[model samples]
Target: MSILDLFKKKPKVNGIIKYLNLEGWWLNELSDEEREIILNIYSPMGSENSIIEGEICSSSQTQLHFFWGLIGWFNKPELRHIAYKLISKAETFIDKSSEPLDVHFFYSTKLEVFYKDRDLRPNGLELAIQSCEQQIANAPAAATAFKQKYDGNLPAHKGYAQLAIILEKQKRYDEAISLCEKAKSQGWAGDWDKRIERCDKRAKA
Candidate 1:
């Protein structure tokens, strides 16, 4: 029986109660079941624009779920591009916001989504490093937000480490060293020291 049919009948009916219990369990257990049902009913894939809009709607809902659950649903390889697009849009909303906390959450969520899928993107590390630099420049307050979200010193240190690596790969030893030193000064742990040592060796070679 259809989910709606179960809900439509009187709650006192035994059959309706059984169906209601099953429907509730199905909805609660499966994340994509509602989407699947809706897609099956509407079949919007036949239209190109409808398909795009449907994907965006689905992604927005999934992102909200992940944000609330801390589930990292966007980490799935098939959904990476969709997640990226949604995050990019969210960044735009963040840029327009005057509230610091709201802006911080937007950027933090965007960064997490980007970081989780970093290995999948062709230039993910470089993009992440550049994104951090841009965020630092545009929203200095976000540093504190990052720290709160990632624990003390982690945000700055992680971003700087990635920047150092990218600069080193580009044969810019001095710049890499500078970022590594900054990360160290910001209380980055032993790994920052290792990065500095590697950069120093590369510079001398």
Candidate 2:
């Protein structure tokens, strides 16, 4: 409460300011200095934007919208790293959001992140799956939304492919094979047959 105490404390940067800056960057607000600061702050959760949920009532949904924007807006192959950082930056906020996590977006986007730059971080895949499961557990209703969406006659169900590949990597062959079979039965296209074949061979060995 003292004048010296006030001077000693740094002015708290507003979360909205950071979010808006990111938004501006998305809109081609290209300032190298500011962009570098934004990237550094987000890359390591060095800012309140990552840790503290802002007063935005729809914080969770807003974050997802922003992430989707980044994913779509940065479609060029060369911008992959920037896209990954923007997506990764949302992880902590996704975890801390009080609202039900957007399960479909969470699963799909993380899967995209996983394959987009597999070795971006040493434990990225594990963390992605852990976050997916945690968010689902925390927000059963939102999880059920995705479940219902992908449940029946889902053609070329990308979700199955993503989740199965993770299980396959973990050497859970039976689960992976079972998932492929389910997807095939549901009329999904793609390499379900090849995936099943691989999993079967692995299980036999």
lDDT of the candidates, in the order given: 0.49, 0.56
Candidates' TM-scores?
0.48, 0.46
**Full-model lDDT, candidate 2:** 0.56
Query: What is every candidate's alpha-carbon RMSD to the true fold?
Result: 12.6, 9.1
Over the stretch 119-196, how does candidate 1's per-residue lDDT look in tens digits?
777977656766656443434455555566665554343345455666888889888888767656655443767767
Candidate 1 lDDT for residue 54: 20
The best candidate by TM-score is 1
Cα error of candidate 2 at position 195, Å = 4.9
Candidate 1 runs further than 4 Å off: 1-71, 96-126, 135-156, 188-190
Model 1 vs truth, CA RMSD? 12.6
Model 2, 91-142: lDDT tens digits are 5455544334354455556556555554667887775565445433443344
Residue 33 error for model 2, in Å? 5.6
